[model samples]
Target: MYDSLWKALKKLPLLPRRLNYAKAPALRFLDLPEDIVYEIVHHLDIRSLCNLSLTCRQLYLSLLIPHLHQQKLPDPFREIHLNGDNCTAAIPALRLLLYDSPIKAFTWRAGHDPRTLVREVEQLRRLIARMSAIEYLELDFSNNWPANEFRHGHENGYWAWVRLATNLLHVVAQRCRVVVVTNHYQVLVPWVTFIGGVPYNLDPPLLARMCAEWRASAGEAEALGSTKLMKSPSKISLSHPDNAPASATFPQPFPPEKGSTVYATRRLIVNDPGLFQRSLFGEWALDWVSNMPLTHLVIHQGRMRLPLLRQLRLPRLTSLVISHG
Candidate 1:
C-alpha cells in the first residue's frame, strides 16, 4: 500500500522536488529554545532588557515571566539621588527609570535661583505624581543661595523662597509617605535644627510667651472639664544659643489618648542645641515634630520636657538616642 501511494504521488505534475535540509534558512534567535533565550536575557542589565522588550511582542511576553522579570529589575531599596547641572535636562530619563521601579527613597537638590528652582520642583512634582511606590522624599535647599541667607537671618528674599519650599513640601507630602525639608546634606534632622535662622536674642522671650499662653489656655480649658473642648497637647521645646537653661511646660498632664492615629517616623536626628529657641512666625519651632510619623528618634545636644516626651505617641519607635550638652 505504501509503494502504491508513493507511485501515485510521483505521477502528479504539481508535485515538487523534495527540499535539501542543508539549504533551509538558518534558525533565528527567536527560534531558539525558550530556556536558552531566557538564560541570555537574564544576563542583560535592566536598561538593555527594557530595550529588548520593546523590540517585539514575543520578547516582551517572555520578560513577563515572573522569575525572569524579578531578576532583571533594579533593587528598589537603594536610594536614588537627583542633582547636578544637567538634572533639569535629565528629568525625562529620571521619570522613565522610576516609572515602574520600586524605588522608595529620592533626594532632590534645589539649585541657586528661585525661578529656576521652582521649575525644577514642578518637574519633580510631575514625576512623583506618577510614582506611587516612592515612600520617602527629601528636598535639599542647601544649594539655594537664599536658603543660606534665611538660615543666618540675613533676610534677602528669604521669606519668599521659604514659602516656596513650604508649599513644595505640602504638595510632596500628599504623595510621599515621609517628606523631609533640610538645608544640610543630611536627609533627616530635628525640627528645631531645620529652623536655625531665628534670632538668638529673642529665643528666651519668645519661648516664655509661648509657654505662658499655653499654660493659661490649658488652665481655662481644664476648669470647664469639657473633654471635647480640651485641646490636644502640642510637642514644644526651646533652648538658647548662649546655653542658658530655657524650658516650657503645659499646665495639664498629657497622656496618650485611645484610638488616636499615630504616625511613625523611620529616623529622627536632632543635632542643634538651640533649634527650638525661637518661634517660627507665631508657632513653636518644633511644634511640627509631634505630627510626624516617628519610628527612630535621636536627640543630640537638644532638650525635651518630661511632659512633652510622655505625650508623644511613637508606636513604631525601636531606637532612641539622647545626649546632653
Candidate 2:
C-alpha cells in the first residue's frame, strides 16, 4: 500500500496545489530514505521525472545531478527521443545542455520549419563540437528536405550531412556507447527515387567509418579492462504485431560481448501507402549495425530483413531475442 501510494504520487501530474503535498504524510508516510528518493527519480520514466520535477525544486535538482542522472533509466527516458515535430523546442534545450553541461546522450530531429530543417545539419556540427562527454547518441531527421527551399538544392544536400557526420564521428570516436541516425518515415519512400541522386541522403561512407571507429575503440577498451556486454536492437517490437510476416522483419546479429546488454531499434514504421521494404535512406541501418561489434540484439518495431542471416554478419553473436519478430 505504501509503495503503491508513493508510485501514484510520483506518477501524478504535479500542479501548484500538489506541490503543497510534498509535506503531506502520504508522501512522507513511507518515509523513503534520501538515497532511495534519488534512485527512484533517476530510474523512473521521463513522465515520472516530469512529475517529480514539478513537485519541488529539490526533486528537480536531484534528477539532474550527474551521478544520479546516469542510473538505471526507465524505457521512455533511457534512449534519447526527439520526434520530428518537437525539434524546435527540443533543439534549444539540447543546445543549452550541449553548451553548458556534459550530457550523457543527446537525440536530434528536424522540426516542422523548412529553414530549421535546412540549418539543422549545421547546428549539429556546432552541437557535436561541444558535447564530448556524450556516451549514447541518436540522430533522426525529417524527410521534409524541401526541394524548392534548397540553395540550388546544394545547401540541403547529402554533402551537408557529410559535414555533420564528420564532426559527429570525430568527437564521438572518443567515448560513445551507441549512435543511431535515421529518417522518421524512411520506409514509406520507394527505392528508385534515390538512383543517380548524388548520395543525397545521409553520408553512407561517413557512417561506415564511424561504425568502424567505434568497433576499434570498443575493442581497445575491452582489451585494457574487464569487458562488459553491449546490447541494443531488442527483439520485442512495440509498433508491430506479434505475428507479423517474416518479410517484415530485419533483426540484427547478437550484440558484441562487452558493456551491459543494450536494445537498439533503428528503423521506420510506415503508415502511408506504397511502403517499400527498404528505406529512403537506403539500408544504412542494417549495414551500419552489421559493422558494429554489438551483442544481445533487441528491437521494438519496424520491418525486418533476412540478409542478416546470410549477407550481413556480426561475429560477436551471443544471445539472440525476438519479442515480436
Candidate 3:
C-alpha cells in the first residue's frame, strides 16, 4: 500500500521542478562591435566566412567591408574559377563578392554542349562588364573534346568552335588586360606567369582579322602621336581609327610603349600550330605577331619559323615555350 501511494505521488504534475528549469542563453554575435566582429571574422576561411554571413543581415553588412575582405580572404580575391554546371548557380555568390571585392581574373571551363557553352560565355561577359577593373580572363573549351582528339575538321566542329572562341576573345580583350583561350588544359596562374600546353585548331582567318583591326587602330594612334590628347580622360576613345576624327585617334589595342605616361602592358598566348605552318605562314601570320603585345608566347606541336619570329613586335617577351608538333 505504501509503494502504491509513492508511485501515485510520483505520477502527479511537478510544478516545483517546472518552475526551477531555465532556458539557455542565446549567442549574440551581432552584439559585438563591428570592428571586433571583423577581427573575429579575420580568422575564418572563405567557407566559414560565407556561412557566418548567412546567419543574419548584421553579419552580412559587417563582412562587406573592403579592407576586411582583402585581409581575410586570399590575396587577389579576384581570381575565380567556374565549371559548366556551377556557372549559373555561382552568379549570386559572385555578385555578392563583387559588391565590395574587385575581380581581376576569371576562368570558365565549358562543358560538351555547344549551346550551353555559348550561354555561359554570354553570362560571363555580362558579369565582367559590371566590374570596374578586370585584368585577366580565360575561357577554356578543351573540356568539350577528349584528350586524344586534336584533329580539326567539321567532324570536330572546328569552324563553329573557332568563330565562338574568336568572338569571346574580342569581347574579353575590350575589358581585360590579358585574354587567354585554352583548348585542352587548366592553367592556374595569371597571364604574366601562365605555364601550360598550347591551344589547337585556331582559325587563321579570324585571327588575321583580329590582328588587322588591332594593327590598324594602333598605327592610327601612333600616327597622331598627341601626348595631351591621349592623356585627356574626357577625350579618350578606343574606336577604330577610321571612325575617329582626324584630330584624335583611338588608343592601341594593347598598351602603348612602356616608360611613356600613356603605356599599359598586355599579353596573349596562341597555341595553334596550324596557323604557323609553312604554307599558312603568310601576311596574316606576320600581321598577327607584328600587332600583338605578347610578353610570353607558348606554341605546342609546331615549329616557330625564324621569319615569323623576326616579325614579332613583343619587345616585352620574357618567356617563350615551344613543344614538339
Candidate 4:
C-alpha cells in the first residue's frame, strides 16, 4: 500500500516548495534611518528643502529634527537680488521667500524683458500678500532705458509698468513702517509728482490718471485716520552717497508752533553728509528726518554741514556722533 501511494504521488507532478522566511516590508522614503535622512537634507538647498517638507508629515518632522540645528547648515538663499544678471533666478527665490522665509527688507530691479514684467509684478504682489508688514522696500524700474524704448513702441505699453509699480507702492506703503526707497530719479519722478512736490508731465495719460487716483487713495487713507498705514522709523541710516538726488531749492521750514511735525525716530544716522543737501531726494529724506524726535544723531565719513545739522530740533538729544570723513 505504501509503494502504491508513493507511485501515485510521483505521478502527480512535484509541487514547488514555499519558503518559510517572511517577505521584507517595502522600503519607504520616511522609513529611512534618521542619520541617512539628515545626510540627504544637508545636500539640499533652501528651495529643495522647502519642497521636501511638503511631501508628508513624517518627512516634515524629519526636516525639523534637532540634528539640523546642531549641524549649523548655511542657507545660500538668505539674501537674493533679482537684478538683471540674476533675473532668471527670481522664480526660485520668490518660492523660497513665499514658502520658507520672510525677509524684513527687499529690493528688486526691473529686467529688460517686457514679456516677464507683468509676471514679475504679479509675483511681487503675491509676495507682499504673504507679509504682515515690511520694514523697507525699494523698486528700481530704470533699466528700460533709451535702448529699450523702441521695444515698447506704443504709449500704452509703458503705462503697464508704471501702473504696476504705482499700485504696488500704494499697497506696500500701507503695511510698511520704515521707508519706501525709490533710488532711481526716473522712478522717483512719478512719486514726487504724486506728492505734488514736483511736476513731471508724463507722456502716458494712463500714468497721469493713475497718479491722480493714487493721490485720492492716499488722501482717503489719511482722512480715514489710518494712522497704522505707515509709522515713522525708530532708527534710520542713510549710507549710500551715490543715491542722493540732484540739487533743488528748499522752502523755509515752518515755525515749530505753526506747522512743525514730529516723528517717532529716536536715532538718525547719515553716513554721507551729502544726503542732507537741498536735492529732491536729499530734501525728501531730510524733511522727514528734521521732524524726528531724535535722541541720537550720527554723522560719518563726510564733511558735516553745521547749517543742515542745526535744522534738526532734537529735544531729547543725548548722543551725537560726528566721525571723521
Candidate 5:
C-alpha cells in the first residue's frame, strides 16, 4: 500500500523541489528587504513618491532619502508665463517661492523711456535672483530704448534697474553654474535681451553695460562668449501701413544661424512698427544680451526681395535664408 501511494503522488502535477523551496515563505511580505524595495520605489516619479509616502510606515521611511526624491513632480508645480503686457507672473506656486519655485525666466517688458525702463527693471531684478536653473529667459527691450539720463538720485528708479540687472545676472549665472555641476541636464533657456519701452526706444548703452557686467561675473573658462545670441525673424506684416507703404522697407535676405531660437514664423502681422520691433527684438533678446554674451548673428526668415524697402546691409550676418509664399 505504501509503494502504491508513493507512485500516485509522483504522478500528480507538482512543482519541482527547488522551485517549491524558493517560493516566498510566510511573513516575507512584512519583512521586505530595503534594497529591493528601494529599487522598486526609485522607479517612481514625484507623484509616486508622494503616494508611497502615504502608503505605510516602512515605505514612507525608505523614500525619505533626500537624494532620491529631490527632483520635481512630473507635473510642474507652477505655471509661469509672459502675459500680453509682458509682465512675468508665476501662477499658483507663490507659497513655494523660495522653496520649490525657483525663477526660471524673467523680463523687463516694454513700457517707458530707456531711463525709466532701466529703473523699472529693478523689481524684475530681485525676482531673477532666486532661480537656480533657468530654461528660457526673456530680457524684453532690444529695440528703441530712450537714451538720456542724469546721475541723479540713488533712489531714482533708473539707477536701480540697470545696476540691479547687472547684479542679478551674476547671481543667476552662479546659480546656473552650480546646477550644471550636479546634473547633466540638457536644458533650452530662451535668455531674452531687452529693456522696457512704452513711449521711447530701447537703451543700447544700458544693455551693453549689463552684458559687460554679466560676462565680468564669470571666472576664466566659465564665462560665456557671444555665440549665444538668437537671431531676429523676418518682417511679416498682415496689414500694410498706409503711411509706410509695402514699398517702404523690403524684406532683407537673411536666415537664422544654426542654433537660432527665433525661426519658423507661422503668421505675419504688423500693427505698429513699435509693436513689431518689440515683438521681434524687445525685452527677450536684450535680456539675453545682458545676462549672456552673444557673438554670432542670426537673421531669421528673409527673402531675396520684398516689395518694400530696398538695400539690405547686414554684413555681420552669417546665416541667410530667403522664403516666399
Candidate 6:
C-alpha cells in the first residue's frame, strides 16, 4: 500500500514551483578596435588566427589579411614571390602586408613580352617603394630579352627598359641590402656579334644609357651636396668642358683614380654572362664596384677576365664569387 501511494503521488503535480532563467547577449568580437584585437590575438599561432578569420568577414580582413607578414609565420610572409600576373592586383594587400612588416626577400619573375616589360616594371617599382627595408631582391628578366626574336621592333623596348632599370636601381639601393639582377639570353646568330660584340637588345648603347643615368643621378646628388653614397672629384661633371651634353662623353670609362661611396646596398649579384664583357662595359663595371662600399659581390655566367679581376680593389669586400662559362 505505501509503494503504490508513493508512485501515484510522483505522477501527480501537487504544487507548481516558480523558476527564473537568465539569457545574456552574445559577445561581439569585431566591435573592439583593431589595436585591441591585435593584442588579444597576439598569443595566437598562425593556424589559430586563420581559424578565427573564417568566423566572419570583418575578422578575416582585420586578422588574416593584415597579419600576412607576421614574423612568426613561415616564408610566405617573410619572403614575397610575385610574377607578372599578380603584380598589380596584389598592391593593396601588399601595402597592408608590407607596412612595418619584417619582409626579408622579394622576387619578381617577368614574361617575354617586350612591350609589357616597362609597364610591369613601373608597377613593380610602386610596390617596392612601399616595402620596408629588406635583405634580398631578385629581379629575373631572363624571359624579357630573347636574342634572336623581335629584332625589328625591339629598340624602343630596349630604351624603356634602360630608364626603368635606372630608376629601379635607385629605389633598390636605398631599401635593399642585397640585390640580384639577372637577364640571361643566349646568342642565336653568330653574325649579330658584329654589331657591338653583343646582341642588339643588350648592346653597348643600352649599357651606356644605364650608366649615364646613374652618373646623372649621382651628379645631381653631388650638386645637392648629398655625398652620402657618391663623392668623387672625377665623378661625371654636370657641366661638360666643351658645353657638350654629358651623355656624349658617357661612353668613356672612369679615370684610374679610385673613389668610394657608402651605400645601404652591401651586396650585389649579376647573372648575365655578356653583361661585363671587355668590349662592352667591363672597365666601367670594375670602376662602379670599386666605388661602392660592398661587403659581397657575385657575378654568375659572366666573362670577367683575370686581368679585370686583378683591377678589382674593394677595401670592404669580404666575399667574392665569380662563375665563368
Best by TM-score: 6
Q: What is the alpha-carbon lDDT of model 6 when measured against the actual structure?
A: 0.54
- Candidate 5 residue 299 Cα shift, in angstroms, is 9.9
> What 10-residue stretch in candidate 2 is worst by lDDT?
266-275
Ranking by TM-score: 6, 3, 1, 4, 2, 5
Across residues 130-190, which tens digit of lDDT does each residue of candidate 1 receive?
A: 5544455555554434334324331233333333333343334334444444343111222
Highest-lDDT candidate: 6
- Tens digits of per-residue lDDT, candidate 4, 1-325, equal 9999999988997789987998898998777887898888878775687588768876655564332333332232233345554444434434433323333445566666645756676676656555544433445554444434434432333334444544454445444333323232333323222121111221234333433443334323312212232322212122222343556332322212213222333334433334455543344445455555455555542433567766666678887756552
Task: Report the backbone clash tally of model 6.
Answer: 0
**How much does each candidate deviate from the true structure in C-alpha RMSD?**
17.3, 22.1, 16.0, 16.5, 21.5, 16.9
Residue-level lDDT of model 3, residues 71-137, one tens digit each, is 3333325566677655654543455554243355566776544436545665665665455544555
Stronger candidate by TM-score (5 vs 6): 6
| Model 3 collision count | 2
Model 5 — TM-score against the truth?
0.27
The reply for model 3, stretches above 4 Å from the true place, is: 1-77, 91-104, 144-164, 177-179, 184-265, 274-292, 301-311
* Candidate 6 lDDT over residue span 160-188, tens digit each: 34335544655565466666676653221
lDDT against the true structure, per candidate, is 0.45, 0.41, 0.48, 0.45, 0.33, 0.54
Scanning candidate 1 in windows of ten residues, the lowest lDDT window is 222-231
